[model samples]
Target: MSPFYFGWLRWIMVYNSSIRYIDDSLFIDGIDLASIVRQVSTPTYIYSLKRVGENYRRIREAFAPLAAQIHFSVKANGNLAILRSLSRAGAGFDCVSAGEIDRCLRAGAPAQDIVFAGVGKTRAEIAFAVSAGIGWFNVENLAELHYINSSADDLGVDAVKVALRLNPQVTANTHPYMATGHGAAKFGLTADVIRDILTRQSDYPRLSIAGIHIHIGSQLGDTAATLAALDAALDLLAAHPRIRTINLGGGLPVAYRAHDAQPSLGDLVSELIPRLAGYDVLLEPGRSIVADAGLLVAELLYVKRQAGQVFYIIDASMAELIRPALYDAHHEVAPLRKTDREPVVAQVVGPVCESADVLARDRELPALQAGDHVALMTAGAYGMSMASNYNARPRPAEVVVSESGDNWRVSRRRETFDDLAQSDK
Candidate 1:
């Protein structure tokens, strides 16, 4: 084994077994980072297939004795390889767009196992979903309901199964941008609005309310808001006993820092599974399944110091991983190699031309130099799925490390400048 150093000058070998250092180099799933960077190149996304499977099994086992169905949220990672792996494990899909449906289909997920959820689905999108014969539509508003019914009628399809997304007004103490079930959030329908829709259900004969859906927010550490939302939905169900499904949308938080005290999936299952008895339940889990299983490896390009403030610039930018810049999200930054130098306060910035391209600020890491490697931890979720070709920069590639870590396959090849210009009309 290599060596491990934590802030102080002391050194030891074998840190976290999942991600360890051997011969002063980081190894993910037993694959050396120095070799991966040399072959796959830096600024690449590396996912541990074993870790993902472990997470999936953990969630499955937690809800096995309960009436729950695991629907992997496609918006979290959306990589085909990842989707295929989950699909093989009997996990359904929770998609938000026509494109996501297509991706899920391409990933070998059946149409009956895919549920589409979104607030602003266009008429065309609704028609596409109808054509695809998706399982259910998590209708957000009356307009969407009407549009979906009209589209189903136009396509000569039978009754379309749907779940009305209810805004329980339960505040999910997460980022405001991600909170969805609040009274003011532009997502789900209010209770009064839901009642109106039920009263007028006969008007849209082509739509059938098959279930109730509620998603409070992402990165939720506590279960209070989710429980409140569920109770609100259950109250509505008392008046309408025909609704058999409850879609507790994905918002299970992940621990971005080592010290974070995020609850386990078992904790959630223990608290909610019993309450959801006697009903067919659906859970849309995104980040909780893949976040901790992935990492973004970047190559340090330059080290700058000015007025006692130090900055370490890397090849990755917001164009590659936007969670930090978009949500002001926190992701642990760590050196890929062991170091004995005293820890220094520094900001880890990326190559994006914008000032908000910072990944982590006021962080401490071993003094790193050019050509060294660092990883953005817990980046498997919103990291690449939210990436863009900002500043005309091509996106990074992705590699899925096999169970043994002895074999790693490139799930996606690095984009070229030509790829960026292909859609330029």
Candidate 2:
């Protein structure tokens, strides 16, 4: 391998332990990328089950001192195999919709271990969750509380556990699109509303207001906003002695750049465990656990040179992964096969019709040609979960590699043209 290839390999390996290279071939968990492509074709999502287990165990061990419950966020990657692996490893689930809850149940997660959370929970979703005997509901507003209470009463279920989500009004150091803790965000109730609701707790006789949930946002780079939110929740807990559980929503971040300096999980846990002595703590981690565990592999379709700029067009597009188009997210692209060719500043684009379908802009990648396979690094989270079928393109398949790296299987088969129009009457 040349210096450029070595540098690229070393950079990606820093994010997760499952990615590596063997004899100039990129392998995820010891399974060669070429072998997977030969079996499942390109534009398939390949996940390392080993990495998923490792990430989950890391969080569990870090919060072991507080005996905190770690709930894997389902909105990150809801593939059945992924959820099943986490469930088997003793992970509870954090679901944002009735469909997510159903996915968890199908994946063998117990209903009592799932937490239903969302800004808008419809009456049907609440009724379904209540009937399913869900463990907790992260209530966002007073109207939601009334809905839950009424649903519980109609179902003859009493003392249904509910957590009031508070908007700490502290702006987190993240993208404005993902920020939810600020006062203007439509995620949680303000402090005054929470206080007033607590004072009138007796109004909801069927609901058990036992927890306080505060989630500032995703991809949090610092602890300032989180700590401030924690303080606010703690203050509320102090005033309301009946509230014993503190649900700290997940915002732990994963590094997209090789040199990115993200806070260590242990450091955050150390700052948190001390203040959460008497209360039950819950964490809902999504991206930090899976973002680096998987990759999106695509085959180069054309090499276009337009206006003196190089564009590597791939079979994949915003339909498969939309972070770049949606949030201007950065996901490093690496060639599956190593070469000694000098690196060039090129843009990786998809076949989407929109101009915003660029994946990586001005990235220093080895000169690639048609039929060359490339993998997008740190795409395990928000990739498949946010995918769309724009321009009538079928979505890609998903594969999971076992811990030993010796076994792999297609978890989700690629969609066909017939499958696309199956919903039509």
Candidate 3:
């Protein structure tokens, strides 16, 4: 491989044991991506179970000193196969809705291992979770608490474990849309409100206030804001000594670019374990665990040059992977087959009919022609989960490579035109 390709792979942080070059072609878990694309077709998602397991075990080992429970956040990627793989690996789930909880259950996760979390939990969702015997509810407001209590009471269940989500009001260094711990964000309750709730704990007799949950935001660059949020939670814990668990909501970031600065898992755990010596710890990690384990492979349709700008349009669009359009995020683009052609600076665009449909802006990539395939690196998390039927475009297929790196299968078949309107009357 050329230094350029090696540098690009390092930039995305996917140049690991599971992902590398085999005879100048990109192979994930010892299986050629081209072969998978040939079977599943273009605009497909490919995930490596080996990489997912490695990432999960890395975090689990880092927090071994604290004996923290790892709850993989389902909103990141709720595919049944992915859930089942993590469940079999001894991971619990952090679900934002009853549907996610059911997905986890259907994937073989025990009900007691799931935690229901969200700012707005519908009455039906609360009832469903309570009836399903979910282990914990990260309650954000008094209304949710009342709903959970009512649901538990109706179900003839006593002492449903609850975690009061505390809005620490700390500003984490991340995109404004992703920052949830700020005072202006509508995520968790304020300290004063939590104090009042704890003071009047007798009102909700069916609830057990067992933990304090704090999730400031996602894609956190360092531990400063997390430490600040933890300090705030500790202050609240001082007044209420009964709360034994502290659910540190997931914000651990992954390297989206070569120069992206992120906290190491070891460093983060080292700083956190001391403060949470006696308390039970729970971590909800979503992106850090699976983001780098997947890819979005799209086939180039046309190469156009207009007004001194080159655009390599592909079959995939924001409808399939919208992080670039949604968060101005970066996903390293690499050609499936290596080439010695001169590199060109061009924008990798999609077939979507919007100005924001560009996947990569002014990126240097190997010279390529129509029909050549490209892989959007680090798309395992928030890729398919956020896909939509926008522009009436059918979604793509999803394939997963086994942990052994010797086999692969299509986990989700591509959506067809008729399938798009299957729900319509």
Report every candidate's CA lDDT.
Answer: 0.86, 0.90, 0.90
What TM-score does candidate 2 get on C-alpha atoms?
A: 0.96
Which of 1 and 2 is the better model by TM-score?
A: 2
Q: After superposition, how far is residue 394 of candidate 1 from its true place, in Å?
A: 0.5
Clashing pairs in 1: 2-22, 2-23
**Candidate 3 accuracy as TM-score:** 0.96
Candidate 2's displacement at residue 123, Å, is 0.3
Over 155-191, each residue of candidate 1 has an lDDT whose tens digit, in order, gives: 9988799999999998998998888888888989999
* lDDT digits (tens) for residues 73-119 of candidate 2: 99999989999999999999999999999999999999999999999
- Cα deviation at 418, candidate 3, in Å, is 1.6
TM-score of each candidate? 0.94, 0.96, 0.96
RMSD values, in order shown:
2.8, 2.0, 2.3
Candidate 2 stretches greater than 4 Å from native? 1-15
Candidate 3, 1-425: lDDT as tens digits:
76666644543324656776677788998898999888789899999999999999989999999999999999999988889999999999999998999999999999999999998899999999999998899999888888888888999999899999999999999988889999999999999999999999889999998999999999997789999999999998898888899999998899876355534888888898789999999999999988989989999999999989899999999999999999999998888887778677889999989999989999988789999999998899999999999999898899989988899999989999999888999
Q: What is the C-alpha local distance difference test score of candidate 3?
A: 0.90
**What's the count of clashing pairs in each model shown?**
2, 0, 0
